[model samples]
Target: MNFLRRVFEHGRFGFVLLLFVLMVSTLGWKIVDLHVFDHDFLQGQGDARSVRHIPIPAHRGVITDRNGEPLAVSTPVTAIWGNGRELQAVRDQWPVLAEALGQKPGRLSERLEQAANREFIYLARGLTPEHGQQVLDLNIPGVNALEEFRRFYPAGEVAAHVVGFTDIDDKGREGMELAFDQWLAGVPGERQVLKDRRGRVIKDVQVLSNAKPGGELELSIDLRLQYLAHRELRNSLLEFGAKAGSLVMIDVRTGEILAMVNQPVYNPNNRRVLQPGVTRNRAMIDVFEPGSTVKPFTIAAALATGKWRPESVVDTTPGWMRIGRYTIRDVSRGGQLDLTGILMKSSNIGISKIALDIGAEPLYSMMHSAGFGQSTGLGFPGERVGVLPNHRVWKEAEIAALGYGYGLSVTAVQLAHAFATLGNDGKSVPLSLIRRDRAQEGHQVMEAEIAHQVLRMLRAVVEEPGGGGSRAKVPGYHVGGKSGTAKKVSTSGGYTDDAYRSFFAGLAPLNNPRIAAVVVIDEPSKGGYYGGLVAAPVFGRVMAGALRLMNIAPDNLPVETKTAAVVPGKGGRS
Candidate 1:
């Protein structure tokens, strides 16, 4: 009996031992299968949990003025973002993170709830890098800060209309920023990195791609002139109680815009104040009747026809004339005035007779050649090309209106361009907003002799006694320009009775014109609403400063006897 019991115990032990050996052998086989046969698969699964491919942001390009001064620039900034799925695990840290972001806990909670299903989301943007780093130092899982760029305009509102501003993502939204967006946006790069259990980058594994920065844009804006124009226009709007105003100055020799400014300007840096009405660049996009500013071109047309000269006489017997049903009246009696006198007096009757005699085709051809009815090719978005009538047959009233600067519309820039054409001795060059090392090639639009004559005649409007634009005279400079006031078209159709647009268009140093400018005051409610009263002074002051800044010798310096102060040299010469 004892021997049988011992044999059974021995059999039970052998069975248990066999089972243990089988288990050990199977475990060893499985270990070898994973570590050797499926090595790549195992490693990939491990990497999938902690390795990340992240984006490396590239900086945007810079924008400079013609003189190499920084107008718009991109400054390094930071943005806080997160992976919603991973952030959910650290939900308890919501209040702490909210505090760091300067946001309420409830607000942060609501934002998280809205983005619960999103893999990636932005928590805050446009934060300083130091603030962003503090948030990242919290080491909360799934929370990260990315490097970004914010546009900074050094010139601020002074250059807001021309340089424009960008969006939160550094995307160009308006003005020159939008116009040159593609050339100013940068390309992002990709990098592979390894993260720890807390989701913090532990190592940079590899760089998959390199970032490429955007190109620079240099505009022809002279900042000094821009500031001068801005100050004068802003002050004028306040002084005249005008609804809005625009001033445009061009380098006649090069067709380069030296200065362009508008009233009601908003600071591009302040996003909250970016309303559509205030941001509109009225100088380029708004159009109005040229008024008497167009009289110079009309006289140029008459001169081109060989029928009128600077001394040609026009019969203005009663200072009023009837064409069809419309009676054209002068502001004052302009009886028996010459061609120059008609322009100086801004006579509606005398100009009407001249238009009737020379006909509309010649005037249209002349104005069109001077760039009155076409785009300035400035490539600005929403720029309007002013209206100039094109008709097979014209009514006598239309012809008469066209002669005295009516039945037509022009932008302030376009008006400046036309005057610049006259200043360029009838040569029409393409208008440019970008800087050019030299003057652009141009085509002759009118005879140099004719343009010179018209320029000389325009001088009488400012220099001669009893001239309409006497207020436009710049001290110590030979100033020449015309003043105009036209009734604004009402919203319900015909012209408004009370509202009017005042204008002044002219050039300085009349013999060797360097710059031409146009100023427009819209709906001046206070002070005098006449062009001579409101707009001419702005042109005079701005032009005077521009000429002095440019170091152009004054052509109309006061005459005096030989004296120490009178002589330009150290000692008076014989």
Candidate 2:
């Protein structure tokens, strides 16, 4: 009995000791697996649950005028976003959330439902800081505010067409903004971050790449000139009740676009007010028959061929001529006239005789060299290359019509470019929208003497009494320009009777020209339709202001024989 009891006791002690050893081994194995062998795996699983890679947005570049005044700038703003899954749990609080986001509760709920499988959705984009803070103050779950930038235009509608605008995401959509998008957009960066179960960022782990801010862009536009042009064009549109108008000013020496403005302008700050037709940069994109503005070029071709002189007289007694089935007539009889008189009278028959005498090749060559039928290389998006028919296939009527600027079409900038070439002494320089460090070399398009002769004739057209463009004269400055009135081509086929495109292209200070400008009024309804009446006044006003702003000295002082009258209201001497 004693032996049996001892064996049973020993067996019991062994069983308990074995159970204790087994428990210790299992515990040690679990500790080793968790702290050593499977440590990285566990950590990876944990990171996968709570870590995220977040994007860092870079700010867009600033666009400035030639004077370094800001045109388009990026201002700090905030955007609201939500985690749809997290937001679903806060469905009861949706009405308050919707009110804060300026949305209806039903719409918010539907959006959250649609995005339930998605991690994020935009609640509001490009909100003001005050508005964004208002949402954050509510401290609603699943909703967060992200810092972003919204583009602002300081010049507003005055510089709208030139500076352009960006979309909600800060991508360029039009104008210079669209032309140089890549140069103006920066690369985004990324960082590894740790977040809680609710998707709130707990810590930033590491940066993947640094965000680079976009470079600054400086344009050749002068804000002062731009404002002046905008104001004058707007006023003229209102006064004339015209369909539209465009004006462009160029630096003759440098080929820099000093000012470009269009009517029916929309403020870039407010996208809600934008329209398709009003948003276009009309001066660069819209083409119209140049009317009499092409007359100088015709005369230039004649002068270039060594067959014509400034004083050469042509018989335009009846003021009309018939070519094939088409009969070209002047507004009135010009009688017998010299080359200068022909331009002053703007006689169609007089120019037709000259153009026919020169044939098609010389005239086409002259226009081609003057930058017709080509792009200005300003890098503008959708810039039209105006139409200039090939000289090889020209008929007699087409060539004659081209003489008076009807057969071909040109944009306002193209007309300005041609006039600027004349002002630059028949040397053509490439146009630039960006500021240049130095003046560019020009290609000789016509002899200096010929250009000067044409310029002098243009001066007589403005300064001489009874001339077509007499109203174009600036009071204290010598001005030279051409007046053009073209019948607008009908949508179905031939030219319309009542609709017209009025134009004035000119240069100032005949002694040494510095500025070349072009004004075009489309379908003037209230006032006279003639270019001399509708377009010249706009040119005069804009030019006068531009000259003063540029500090150009007045070339025409009171003739020594003329006297100044005294005002009786003040203590000034006459």
Candidate 3:
């Protein structure tokens, strides 16, 4: 009663303030009861009743050869993931869990210990479904598995350089795999899985994620040609004891790459042994001075400028000439060589004189027009745009050397296409490795007459016994080509006297050329190092097998001497 009387005396405002303080105290006590004491238990209960990630792996599409031979295929597999929070909840058993999963206790302890509070973590990726099931059968807490896709390559080494493999996570890493990653990786689906306290999923809500099939890519390569070239090139590498070599076989008429063979080839399936050197796609990635193979381009340029003809003769005195500070000489120097003989003998002085009169502009323009400095746009990974100096940079000696296939760098594929242009009648077109029908060839880059004349000059090279590329001739097929030996340029400057890039570029059935090719050897340690000795024979074997495989009929009549029949005629190589 006294308290009520004092409140009435103090007034209504003071009494109201007292009532508000009592109400706040009651609410604050309730809040304390629900928070500090019960916080951890409440969180645990909520998580135990909450949803978890049910990883639904996407399917990886297939990689196949042009003929439908499987290069890479997805095999069903299982990957293990863990609820880091749950694992940490039972952190004391890290060693036992590690032992059960075939992992070292140290490694396992680090992982679980680190992920103790994390919401998710991947324990292992791409385990075989069988192995995954074995793990699941162990029924350990916190660990879970999912059926995933694992990529496998059956053709292995045969397609290793073409179709690259993927990572353990099914992501494309290199080769066509990386180039077409979007198409190769199918869309993944998702599902909802309810888990119990043991971390085992109690139920799965099906979420179908149908995979979109990848588009099939057709290649221009014939497996038979690929196999033949592979076998022959491999054998040559072993027989010659050479460091490395590259061969590119192209269709003269269409510019299709039939077989791109390289030495030290690795299996795409098992790429563990691949080093940077062996894995380089030399035909597209590496460049070198083309040697004598560039002779045809020079001859074609001179002919285009109206300064020379097949019959034009140049007196190559002493077979050597001092142009500026450089001494230009033919291997067989000092001869009165005609245009045909010049190419047949690979006369450096003769070609240099022609380049001198034509000057650097016309020749460079011709080469540019021939697609020398440009990229082939092959969709090749790490492909380089071969180096071609500007006309303004042509020093005196450089001009002479450039005229005879020096002072320039080109890829094996580039040389093959340039020769193909001459085969196509002075019209060089873009070369493609993808299979295309006859009608899709689009345009022509060489004049038929010019192409025919170039073919005639090349024929002289093989038909004449003393011709530069005489070794490239095959029996019953009128073959034409040029030989080149280029001293490698050292990084410190100048040139290395011993290291050379031997090269050969030619076409078959000179009457109606259907295939053009280039064979290049880098640092061939073989005893005889001329292009004629080392590269031309490989070109011959490659062409012979290619001709037979491509079903190109022989032009020359069969005779006792296959070499005699293919040699230049009464016209002497026309």
Candidate 4:
């Protein structure tokens, strides 16, 4: 009995000792694993559940005019974002959240269910900070206000087509915004942050990447000039009851677009109301037959061949000519007009005779050198190269039609560029929408003497009494320009009777031209559809204001004022 009791006690003690050693071994192993072998791994696993790497959005750049006037800027705003999984748990607050977001509860619920598998989703974008803050104060699970920017156009419709607008994610959609997107879009950053179970950011753990703000874009537009152009174009459209219009003002010396305005403009801030036609930059994109505006180029081509001179005369006594079953007529019988008289009267018969004399090659070369049938290299989006046919394929009738501006097409910018070449003394410079620091090298397209002679003739068109462009004359300034009225081409194929595109292209201060401008009024239904009556007055008004604003010295003396000896008041008359 004693031996059996001793065996039982020893077994009990051994078992107790074994249990203690096993407990000590387990505790020691756990300590070693946590403090040495698997420390980083366990910590990383814990952090994965509570920490997040988030993106820090970089601000887009500001777009300014040449004078440093802000056209487009990024305004600070807040966006409501949410974690779908966490947001789903806050069903009770869904109605209040929906009301804040301007959505119905059912819609919000549906969206959450649809996004249940998504980590992130936008609840609302482009909310004012005050409104976004109110939502954040609700403290609904997973709901947060993220810092963002909304594009704002200070000039509104006056500069909308040039500055453009960004999409919901701050990506450029149109205009200069799209053209220089990469330069205006900055690099985003990353940061590691600690988040709570409810998906709220608790603290920033570390910054992984630094945000680089976008670079500034300075354009060649002059805001004052742009506003003037916009106002005048708008007024002209209203006065003439036109379907659409466009005006482009360029610096003759540099080929920089000082102002570009299009009628039927849309506000960039209101994207919902934007239409495709209203959003198009018509000055650079839309092409039309230039009509009589192209006569100067034809005249230049004739002069370039040394076959025509300012005094050269063409007989238009009958006012019409037949070219292979096609009849070309003049507005009236010009009756043996000179080169200058052809432009002054806009005689179609006279110009066609001149073109036939010069042949197709010379005329085509002049048009091509003036920047037709090619891009202007402005890098604008959707810019069209106006159509000019190959001279080799031209028939005799086609060549004659082209001379009077019917067989080809040219954009408003191309027309302005061609006139600018004339204003620049026969040198054609590349067009620029961005401000250029140095003078650009120019291509000598026509002889300086010939260009000057054409300029003189254009002056007669405006300054001379009862001329085609008489309405374009500006007091105290020698203005030179041409008028054009073209029948609109129909969708079915031929020209429409009542529809017309009126055009006026000109330069100011004829002696030393500073500005070149083109005004085009499409399908005027009220007042008049003629370029001289409709389009010329717009150019004259806009140019007069622009010249005054730029402080250009008057090239012409004021109407000789008769200074009558100041007869003192009637009582003091001597």
Candidate 5:
């Protein structure tokens, strides 16, 4: 007790106690600072190193034909990525990694070097699950896989121009894919994730939002008919050695496009050979002078005047007629012919005389009313509204040219739409790429009687023995069609003599028209370039298959014979 009192009195015990108190206070203050004042900062730093909000990939919509056949689909795929900073540390393993990824070691190293400062970098994208799993099994540092979707086209190049294609990120780039991208692309979700230092997700903490999957799109196209058209058009292109071609088929009842195809197509699945010319949707985007196909509309124009009938005579004693500096000549002698006979012969002089007499405004009115010089309202990307010059003062030659389906331009779809209007009793219906629940209402563009008369005239062009469109006949169907071969306009100014655009536009089963189609072949280098020879045959085969596929009854089927029936009671002679 005396020693303890001595120590306390000397201040040594108090000094030791003060030192202990100071040490405890410093530790307590440090604990408070870490838990309170510096808590958010520390937590934020940790989160910056390990916590992440990653995107939960949303799948693109499925595109289907009218019959519910899948055309375009999105398949789940795995893409490999890495933390460039971490990957740089594992440079020795890059050769093995590069081999598994089917990449050159040198290239992989170079890519990694370029991205060494990045926290995240794509190593390999669009990998199959098995392939990605194999890479992950190696357990290479900094390597990770993310879920993604790759667009797959089942139709390949056959429907490439129609369905279009998507980019690496699954965004639409062309065709209906680009046209309805918003509707087809869904909203991606967000999720909180806990990641490691190497950028691999260790845990999925929580989903901030749910992914909304894209909606399904059902197009009006019939896959069967599309295949048929595609096959027939491709054959014709090969046969004629044509530079390019386009074919369009429409359901006249609903104005729904059954099939639309273009040549020089590219595979949406393989885009290595993608070029603007190869991927062009020519049926909707490109235009050419329709040539003589417009004669039906001119006849309709004449009929609308109330002065000309289907049987009205036009004197064309000479085979040629001079207008301005150009001379219009017929292939055969143009005798005195009624409108029907003139259409059958496809006489340029005869049609020209009718046009010159009717004047320009009337012909323009007819063509304009037939859905020419306008968009088809299909909402297609880059669709051209063909040029129909509505010049206030029309030259005499221009008037004649308009009568013969020249001096203006039209797309294959536009020409098909016009013929569909004639098949629908002169009502112009809106063209559709999407499937319609029912037939939409249309406005009458011509008198029903006048339209019927024009249909009969068109029938003469196909049914008559010497008709130009005789090759377009379906075996057991009464078809009405017109053929046109227009000279391609030269880049300098005048028309090119060697280059020609062949076209055939018509509807099948004239009695009750169900389908209307147009075929246009650009620059047929071999065989023949005439519309009847090059385009009409294609139209015939495609239309025949289309009619059969749709189960349309043949209007020209031979009449059934009545069998003589003798009842068993006839023996009684009642």
Candidate 6:
């Protein structure tokens, strides 16, 4: 009993000890629960923190011209990327790292903040390799360089319309780049990367994405001819005080487009300096009244149907024919002229009369067969099928005027191709802007004999004294063609007072012709506005150039055979 009493006296110390023991036991139970009972949950949380993601880039394809000239290419560049966790842990050396990278401390602070919040972020894009190496020498925690592609145009402005340009992401934005974006942009590949506790790269377990290189694209444009045509067209546009100009050269035998050029051109490489009109491809997109250039088709149609012969006389004594409310007048008061003289003078009366004889049926058929009123099938974009009112839309006066190159629209290419029909022995083939080295099948409209005769008459049109197209005469080559001028369309109605479309379509070496060309001047208000004055000289230069290039030998034949060659294949065309 006495010992129990003594132990009771020390009960305060025992009570304090008991309370401390209970507090320690409660804390131990909680630590056990967190470390053992919920071990899987804590492990999952730790694993989420240790995981990291990285990006892999795909390489785009290269673009080359027909002769393997590089239009666009991809080059290697460096990207500055940072690791958020590592940079946060090594915050002490940040000022030194910023000084080495030539950046202010505040800017780096913002970058660090972004890295902490965002798993992946670019500190810099499209930096040069040298710049990247300088950044790497700092050995800044969490910051490194990445590989990327930067687009480049080697030709610069040489072939901008063909090669196209790309955005900063290496995506095709314009021209063939946009047209063939699918082939140029390859499938992107990806991989999953692993990191240790300190965020250092450890091991790569699996690849989630496969890398692919873009496919190649080859163009049919000849770089040399394209450059030549662009140079000449620019000179002409500047010299003539004209708004713009376009020229196209076609191979008579193969239908390959040797050259196509338009002024107000833009270099695809320097797109920022270009206007919308500069990028327009007028050779295919713009359609205008081809003036007297269209007369050959009517003359050919008249001769082919046996309705009118080249020697056949027509009463164009008055030089004007009044029909309904419209009066059709020739360029001059030509006396009674045979088909040959009428064409030489570009008489509206003679062509109108011939159109009446042949009727709307044959005229429409000839134009359609000549590849007018339809697309050229050149395999490029931005081409228009020129507007030609159907025969069903033809009224008496309208149809007659259409015969003289009015009330309808056609592309310069189509007009050149129509004359090519006569030069090609009355066969109409599809016009090709691309380089085609194979045999192309053509559709025959007029027989070879009739086409031969028509060629002769066109030669007479150029060879005759005081002829409108005398400027088209080429040395060492017999050339024949027609000249035409039409008042341009106005916003109000009828024709604009001063605006005109001057045009000429010609074939060289009248005997066994080889090449054909067309020249057009839009709104040419220069000193000489006539097609004979403004457009024929252009034809002469281009025709002579083409003849020399093709090595077409001259025909030393007498004027008789040359004249007879103009005869219509079926009728007395020449």
- Candidate 1 residue lDDT tens string, 236-257: 9999999999999899999999
State every prediction's TM-score relative to the real structure. 0.90, 0.91, 0.85, 0.92, 0.92, 0.75
| Candidate 5 regions with alpha-carbon error over 4 angstroms | 1-30, 33-45, 563-574
| Deviation from native of the Cα of residue 265 in model 2, angstroms | 0.8
In candidate 2, what are the lDDT values of residues 151-198, reduced to their tens digit? 999999999988888999899999999998888888888889998887
Model 4: residue 502 alpha-carbon error in angstroms: 0.2
Worst 10 residues of 4 by lDDT: 565-574
Weakest 10 consecutive residues of candidate 1 by summed lDDT? 563-572
Error of 5 at 417 (Å): 0.2
Q: Put down candidate 4 lDDT per residue, 1-574, tens digits, no spaces.
A: 9999999999999999999999999999998998898899789888999989888888899999999999989888999988898877878988999999888889889999999988799999999999999999988888987888888999999998878788988999899999999999999999999988778889989999988889999999999999999999999999989999999999999999999999989999887966878889999889999999999999999998988888988899798889998899988677989998999889999999888888999999999999988999998999999899985477879999989998789999999999999999899999999998866998999999999999999999998875788888888999999999999999999999999999999999999999999999999999889999999999999999999998999999766755546565654422
lDDT of 5 by residue, 1-574 (tens): 9998897777987898899999999999988998898899788888888999988899899999999999999999999998888888888999999999999999999999999999788999999999999999999988999989999999888888889988999899999999999999999999999987666778989999988999999999999999999999999999999999999999899999999999978888888767777888999999899998999999999989887888899887778878878998998785999999888888898889999988988899889988899988888989999999988788999999899988898899999999999999899899999999888888898998988999998888898888889989999999999999999999999899899999999998999999999999999999999999999999999999999999999899899877666678675332
What are the per-model C-alpha RMSD values against the true structure? 6.3, 6.2, 7.2, 5.1, 5.4, 9.5
Candidate 5 weakest lDDT stretch, 10 residues: 565-574
The lDDT of each candidate is: 0.90, 0.91, 0.78, 0.91, 0.91, 0.76
What candidate 3 gets wrong by more than 4 Å, as runs, is 1-49, 52-55, 88-107, 110-114, 197-199, 439-444, 559-574
TM-score-sorted candidate list, best first: 5, 4, 2, 1, 3, 6
Cα lDDT of model 6 by residue, 1-574, tens digit: 9999889878978999999999999999888987989788777787678755666777888887556777788888888777776788788877876776667988987878777856556777677888878887776667776778888888666567555578777787666677777888898777777777545567785788777988876665556656665676666666667777777777787776666667666766456666876666677779988767778788778877886777799889777778888888876878888878878888998888888777888888887888878887764556688987785656778778878888678877777777777888898777764456663899997888878887787888888896788998887678888888888888898788888877778888888877788878776656767888877887787777666655667774445555555555667655
Our tally of clashes for model 5 stands at 0
* Residue lDDT tens for model 3, 1-574: 9999987878987878899999999889767866876687667667658656565666677766556667778888777888888777676777766766678989878877777778678887777777777777766677888788888888666656666678877887766777777877867766666777666778764654544545555667766777777777777767667788888888876677877878878776565666767767778888888878887878887887777777888999887889767787778874888888888888888989988888898788777777777899777778787878886566777777778888788898888888887777666656776666761343444456766887888898898778878778888899999988899999889999888878888888787888888888777786677888888988898888888877889998665643434455555331
User: How many clashing pairs does model 4 include?
Assistant: 0
Of the candidates numbered 3 and 4, which has the greater lDDT value? 4
